[model samples]
Target: MRKIYVVGIGAGDPDHLTLQAAKAIGRTNVFFLLDKGEAKASLVELRERLIKHYGHPHKRIVEGRDPDRDRTPADYTGTVADWRHRRSLVLEELITEHLGDAEIGSILVWGDPSLYDSTIAILEEILERGAVDFEFEVVPGISSVSALAAKHRVGLNRVGQPFQITTGRRLAEGWPEGVDDVVVMLDAQHAFTKHPEADIYWGAYVSTPDELLACGPVAEVADEIVATRTEARERHGWIMDTYLLRRNR
Candidate 1:
């Protein structure tokens, strides 16, 4: 049986790579990359830089075209399921056709493998299909959620309090009942602005060189976050952001 390592390379900055992630890169014979197109070409370069910095020069890279998905669909979950099925097929083919001579292959994921990443899930699907025989190990890295709190110099919850991590779409429906502390990720719509009373600690492109940060009452800083987000997206052609919202302040 072959082995694959699913390594988390951290949020945005190259410096976010942990010693474990660096070691995993050093061990990988082939780096399985999901091509996210030119808009996110910078991410590809970042991954390469990590390999170059940590691994030997002989390591090979295998690129697979990622399946396209409806960014705004009526049935979000259904669309995503279909997309992932297609993605797993693509990934399986890559594993079978690309790594025949290699014994150790790896996927470098952004954030932790346990978070909003799907590489681990797709790998599991491949195993369940009985088309491939490989053992995989997950190496966790610092998530943007943790980086968000660090950059903001604020705690996620008050002493003995609880918090929830949710996406922007779920939050747009309404504030979740009985949850005063909320961390929102993958929010493209500036959903945090809807609640006027909440205190927000927001950051865009966290840990990256083009990082942006703002904190205040949602009403007071909403316009600033919106304007900044618009300008950043226009400039970079893409953006990945997350924020924390707290009420009863």
Candidate 2:
């Protein structure tokens, strides 16, 4: 039987790689890299840099692409189902080719595997098919939300209050009904513009030397975030950003 280790590399910084994640990388015989096409090539480069920095010689790197699909549709659930199906196919193909007998393979995920990541979903699909006998291990890394909070020197939630983490697409569709605090990720449309009540603390490329941060009332700085995000993305060729929004009562 083989094992697949899904290790979070954290957000764009080699130091963010946890000790356990580092060990997992070193132990794995093969490493699979997911390419999000040309728009996010920097992400692929960042992962490569971390691998080289750790000097892990036993690992062989293989590249894979996320399934191309129309993710924005009237039926969001159906769209995601199709996308997952495609991803599962790609992962299965990669595993069959590179995973030798008695070897462990690792996929370097961005941020923590538990947060808004689809690697596990793809793994589940592979498991459903019973194509390969394997066990999955998740090595957690510091999430961008934690990094954002740390950079701003603030807690993610207020005393006795709970916070919700969601994607920008959901936020744009509507505020999460009753959540007091929301942390948004993968927001390409600047969905903060939809809400006026919350205070926003936004950071782009948190923990990296080129990190950019902006914080203020949603109404006050929403445009700034949109403009900044656009300019930065244009300049850097890629951006992995996360933000926290607190609804003040």
Candidate 3:
């Protein structure tokens, strides 16, 4: 039977690639590349570079157009379900055509597959449709949450307390109750401004040369964070950021 490996390539930095991920890259017969449009084209370049350095020279690199996601849709759940359905179709085609019998296929995810990623879920959906028959394995790698904590030089949680990871939408709904440590991801808006008292440790373009970091009370640094994020996005044409917000710390 053909084997499909959902491989995590780490958060931007090649040095962070785990031994297992490197081995997966080396063994993969086909590495699937999902184009996320021009904004993240640089990321694809980085992935190609990684493949050149780690993967076998004669292995195939297959390209697929990822379904467009509505970042600011009115009906979030519906929009996501529609997108997932389209993605599943695309994956089905990739598996049926590009992946052959007894060949090792892989999709190199940006971060660990189990975190905020949907690749694994999409793969499961494709398999559940009863069209693709293959064994899939997930290879975990370092997530941006851990990378953010390390670069910020702070722990995700306080002593005897638990930390929560949420999206900007949830943070906008108001910070989760009973949690002092909140890590926010996929926040296009500066949701941290809603809480002026919280101390924020934020990082953007993490682990790259364009990396940016800011820390201080939300009130004091909100403008700075916003401006920096805007400038970085404008300059680079893209940005991937995450932050840890600690209330009453």
Candidate 4:
């Protein structure tokens, strides 16, 4: 049987690549890439750099256009589902045409596969359609959440307490019930601004050369974060950020 490795490459930092992920890259027969256009060209470059350093000498790299999606949709869940389905079809074709029997192909993910990434789900959808046959393994990498906490030198949860990881959309809706510590990702709207009373540990492009970090009571630093994030996004054309919000008990 052919094999597919969903390898997490870490959040924008070459150093974050783990030993297992390196081995997977070195063993890969093919690497599939989805181009997100020039606005995020650095991301594609990072993948290329890793493949060059650790991948097999004769590894073939294939490219596919990443399916576009609505950033702001009236029906968020439905829109995302449709987008994922489209992406699954794209990747299905890539695997069917490129991957040969008894060879290994890989999809290098930004963060851990178990996080917000859709590669795993896309693979599953392809299998469900009965169009592909391959066994896959997920190689975990450091997540931005973990990187944020580490960069800030802080723990995720309080003693004997649990922390919740949520998207900025849900955080904008409202804080989760009964959790003092909340980690937020994909927060395009700067949802942390809503909870001015809470303390925040925030980092943009964590573990990368262009990393930016800020922390303080939201009331004091919300404007600063917004300004920094906006400026950075304008300068880089994209930004990936995560933050932890701690509420005083």
Candidate 5:
């Protein structure tokens, strides 16, 4: 039987890789890196840096690109399911080509694999099909949410106050009622524009030398963040950003 390790390398910083994650990569026979195309080539480069910084001489590297899917469908769940299926197929193929007979194959994931990452879910589907005999293990790393909080020097939640983790799309639809603190991710639409009254702290490329951070009353700096994010994305060709919003009580 073979074993598979999904190791989170953390957001964009190679130093963010956990000690355990680095060990797992060093012990693996093959390393699979996901390429999200040119728009996100920086992500691929970051993984390469992690490998170069910590990988062993014997570990072989394999790269795979995720296929683009039109996610504008009405049924969000259906679209996500379809996309996962395709991703699983590609991953399985990569395993066969590079590590079919190896004792272990490892994939380096961004951030903690359990939070908002689909790699484990896709691997589960591949396992269910009985196409591969492997045991899955996850090595956690620092999450962007944690980095966001640290960069802003603020608590994600106030004393006794609950917080929610949501995406930009949902925020654009409208703020969730009754929630005072919301951490937003995958926000391509500047969803902060929707809640102009909330206080916001935003960070792009957290923990990296190129990191950009801004904070103020949401009403005061929301437009600045939007304009900054737009310009930054255009300038860098990619951006991985996260933000926290707190409604004034």
Candidate 6:
């Protein structure tokens, strides 16, 4: 039987790699990568950098073209399901072609494997189809949410209170029920603009050299964030951001 390790490589900083994740990389025989295209080349470069630093000298690196999906779909859940299915197919093919018996393969996931990432789901989907056989494990890494909170020097929730982690689309719909602290990710729509009453601790490319941080009352800082996001996106061709919305209740 073959083995796969889904290792989390942290948000963006190289130093974010945990000792356990590094050990897993050192043990891997092959590194599977999905290229998200030219605009996101920096992401691919980061993965390669880690592999070169910690991977075995003769470790094989394989690449697969990531399936493209609609950024804004009327049916979000259905669209994501389809996209994930397509991605699973691509990964399944790569595994079958490149991964040898008894050899260890790895998928270096950004942030953490369990948070908002599709790699694990894709693997499970492939297994469910009975097309592949491999044992796998997840090595957790620092998430952008954690990095954002650390950079802002704030806690996610106040004393004795709970918090919610959600997407920008869900936040756009409305604030979640019963949660004064909301963490938002993947908000391409500038959804924070909808809640001018909340205080936002926002950061883009957290833990990276290009990191940007802003915080204040939404009414006061929303415009600044939007402008900064626009400029950064235009300059870099892509952006990954997360924010904590703390409402006064």
> Against the true structure, candidate 5 has what lDDT?
0.86
Clash pairs for candidate 2: none
Q: Candidate 1 residues 34-147, lDDT tens each?
A: 898998898898888887888767788889999889999999999998999999999898889877554788898888999998888899999999988899999998899999
Give stretches of model 5 more than 4 Å off. none
The parts of candidate 3 lying over 4 Å away from their true place are none
Runs with alpha carbons beyond 4 Å of true place in candidate 2: none
Which residue pairs in model 5 clash with each other? none
> What are the per-residue Cα lDDT tens digits for candidate 4 across 79-136?
9999999999888899999999999999999989999999999899998998789999
Per model, how many backbone clashes are there? 0, 0, 0, 0, 0, 0
Which window of 10 residues has the lowest lDDT sum in candidate 5? 95-104
lDDT of 3 at 171: 96
Distance from true location, Cα of 94 in model 4, Å: 0.8
Q: Write the per-residue lDDT of candidate 2 for residues 1-249, one digit (tens) a residue.
A: 788999998876788998999888778888888788987777788888877766367668998887777745798789888888888888899999889888899889988999888889889889999887688899999988999999888899888888899989888888887668999998987888888778999999898788999998999999889999999989887787889988888
lDDT of 6 at 9: 97
The 0-to-1 C-alpha lDDT of every candidate, in the order given, reads 0.90, 0.86, 0.90, 0.95, 0.86, 0.95
Which residue pairs clash in candidate 1?
A: none
Point out where model 4 deviates above 4 Å.
Answer: none
Q: For each candidate in turn, give its C-alpha RMSD to the true structure in angstroms.
A: 1.2, 1.9, 1.1, 0.8, 1.5, 0.7
**What's the TM-score of each model vs. the native?**
0.97, 0.92, 0.97, 0.98, 0.94, 0.98
Model 6, range 69-171, lDDT digits (tens) per residue?
9988999899999999999998899999999999999999999999999988889999999989998999999999999999999999999999999999898
Candidate 3 — which pairs collide? none
| Candidate with the greatest lDDT versus the true structure | 6
TM-score of decoy 2: 0.92
Per-residue lDDT of 1-249 in model 3, one digit per residue for the tens? 999888888888889889999999999899888898998898899889888999997799988898888888999989999998898898889889988999999888887899998888898898888887989999998898889899988999988999899999899999898899999998987899999998999999788777899999999999999999999889888789999999995
Model 6 scores a C-alpha lDDT of: 0.95
